[model samples]
Target: MTSPVPSVDLRLVDLLRHDLTAADFTVPGVEAVVGPTAAAALHREQDVPARRAVAAVLRAVADPAAVLTALWVLGEDVTRRQVDAALPGLGADGAVALGLVEASGQGADDAVRAAVDLRPYAAQDAVGEVTWWLASDLSELQTGRRLAADHVLGAGGASLTLAQVTMRDPRGRVLDLGTGCGIQALHAARHAGSVVATDISRRALAFAAFNAALDQPDAVTALDLREGSMLEPVTGERFDLVVSNPPFVITPRTGAAGGGASGLPDYEYRDGGRAGDDLVRDLVVGLGEVLEPGGVAQLLGNWEHRRGEPWTERVGSWLDAAGLDGWVVQREVLDPAEYAETWLRDGGSTSDRDPAVWADAYGAWLDDFASRDVEAVGFGIVTLRRPDPAAAPAGRVTLRRLEEHTGSVRQPLGAHLAAVLAAHDRLQGLDDDALAAQRLVVAPDVTEERYLTPGAADPNVVLLRQGDGLGRAVHASTSLAALTGASDGELTVGQITGAIAALFDVSATDLAAELLPAVRGLVTDGFLLLPQ
Candidate 1:
């Protein structure tokens, strides 16, 4: 008879780091192996309770003090006493109480140790300045499962996206919702006067606090770590800037990502939930109330689009409903089936054996969208500026499309805002009389060239280059070319045309009709720059 394949819960392997890191063992290759030795090493590395037990297991094979020194080098936080506390022979109830293993029946430490032994290779590099761990087995599917409370999330495109688009010059206050390891908050605090970071899980919050402390100790002091669902604990509080990389996974959870039996809500850091991307919708809408007037809110989000509906229109409508001036830019779009499979792997679904199950999951995703008439999906960075309703006309919302994506961050974005506001001020102040009298301002690089065919007394055509707005060069009548050439700060269109009439020995009246249009064209097309 054929043997039944064993089903191993992938989430246990995911949480090994949290348990091991807690114990202070420097697991070098948790992502490299499978089975008990890896798990035992992970348990020894992560759990304070597993320290002595893990040490006992290792001492049976390796040097005891050398292992202790390696553990200290990995994390000074772990102590020898803490390792001793995890030693076995303490009682069946005690091992379970100490959290060394899953307390299912009696002594499960052996199983726990076996899992730890499966952890990645733990070793110091040559200089010993930094410790490294491999994640060869940390697949996209594994990442989708519940991440540990102290899960050291691997770097990915999403994290880089958030880093590129987040506001760098924060004012009064800032908040990082779902602050994973406090990366968002850390970046925000460099500019924000005050920062508040919150996560649904305490362990996640603690990790955020630790990372913040390690990087920016003083700013860490200013960070108020709160445990609650998105913005719940901070009701009525507003900020100059609010940033988030919420759990946006569109998957169901099998308990928590961290190992062991913990009741924490599996707030998948990247999941948008199964609610048709409503998680992002609610977050944007919530910021409308939470943002101070003239303040800006930035987010990285994904949206589902129904057939026959323009995605831009749908996203723009959301901003309009929120009563905010938003600049929504859609960066990319994806098809239905491909999107489903990508996320299935992310959610850690071990459906490799069941091709039918994979098809079913894809079918479910399609049906969910089809029922709602969603045809395509979009993901992008959204920037919104809450309007001060009482402010001037220049402060209205604007939406623009970016030409391309540049991986390098645009730091000091304040200059761009200043330029935008300056343009707004200049355009809003234009009166009809000023518009009628607007003069063309020419640049130094502009010149007029006259061309004539074979031996003619008068030039047949006049060419204007660098004088027109942008980089356009055009052929014009001599009268038009003369009008443009005279626009150097020395004279206005009226004066320049009058001089041209005298030079060409033509009537001023005729010149006015011919050159006036060309001068107006130059100013309108921005061939010439006006005084600022």
Candidate 2:
């Protein structure tokens, strides 16, 4: 059976919030107790260093923040007396009543274990910096065991990824599908005029409600919480923005993990209970129905890289069916073996703990993939926008970008993506001559690099690099390079191309023909920017 979720009693939550705030249960507060070394280690899933450091601090004196972190954050057993000292306002009894912790023994000297994981979450989104507490099921680090099937997840790497890439433009109505513990909904509430968050798991909804009440007591009208799977709850409703980090993990449907008494995990939070990557595929094609004509959807998903077929073609087909402007950036590709190990460990089925079970599950994953001739699994972020017929005056498919960028990217990519979309619309509305008449300047973050051979006067290759956004670099032809270098917002594209054509002894018409498309691309990618 799954564990209980935290209670949302307003009076008790207010008291708990008061105690937590008084004790300084925050990111920096915990860092102060555990030190930077231990704090960073904990971020990497190494809790030993943090546990030792917290233990050392607890031994020195009575610090409520340290005690709370030890009990809730670290999942360590803390004495009732210590908890009392830490939370003088709420006391240990109030914590137990709120389902935050459970008594592990009988007396005041007895130890208590955290029934739930409560921690501070801080981030920068469209509205600005925000700091609040989030409550969810305990992790493997605290429980020292595998996750339950119906486990409610807290903020993790994938959650942070979707949050970073989500566009922050103020929207009229936003829908956060499969919102686990309401993390994305909180961010959406900051900029959205109205926010609706939905999920399939009742336990997850409970945690979301508790978190919302704790973090956003005054946003009752702005935030709406609902329960149902995918888009079922909000049928026929259209949203301006839809963001989901859904249950997209591909789990084996038979043998080791299919059912009861098999000693295998069937995680409800990650697995949508559908076979392979079909759940993600359905989301890609189905999201269009719930989005407004000009609405946008942001999702993170996994798609199979089948044998003898390109991954882009596989995922692009979904977009074709979607009939929307789409951009899919494949960040990482893992073979069957690598994918098996990565997920198996995530469920706490580690080799050190149960090698036989791990091996069986690994074999099952291989067998399942082999049944379909799957070569690899591609994980990526998907950004899709339903076509606004008005924006494209002429009938045109505006965007269908499918590429990979595995390197570093600037955080809070919302603004950068919004800029790219604006550029796309602007360029789409312009003809070759119209575009040529306009002046463009290089963005401040762009730099040009020229590579040369030893003892050579002229460079062999020219490259224009973008420092942020997708961190893209493009190879520039000599003509294009010259045109870009002269783009100081003083001269129009026609003037620059004419100058380059005259210097190179080429026809200006042919030169503009060759460079117009390239220049438009540069502007779309933010290497060249339209002057404000």
Report the C-alpha lDDT of model 1 over 1-532, residue by residue, as the tens digit: 1111111222332243343444343443222122345445543333333444445545464432323322322222223333333332233233233222232333332222110111222221111222322221122222223333334343345654565455455378988888765666666777778889888766556555545543455565788889888879689989888777777654333322211142223334665444677777787777888888877777778787788877777776677767776655566677876776676555444434556555565566666667678787777777767766455454565433222232332333333333343343344445433433455566564677777788898888776665321234667887776666666665656677778889989997777776655554454434454565
Cα-based lDDT at residue 187, candidate 1: 68
What C-alpha lDDT do the candidate models reach, one value each?
Answer: 0.53, 0.88
lDDT of 1 at 192: 78
- lDDT (0-100) at residue 93 of candidate 1? 38
Please, what is the TM-score per model?
0.55, 0.96
Q: Which 10-residue window in model 2 sums to the lowest lDDT?
A: 257-266
How many steric overlaps are in each model, in order? 43, 0
What C-alpha lDDT, on a 0 to 100 scale, does residue 364 get in candidate 1? Answer: 64
> Over the stretch 344-461, how does candidate 2's per-residue lDDT look in tens digits?
8888777247777777888889998998899999999999999887886443458999998888888778788888999988887789989998899988898889999999998999
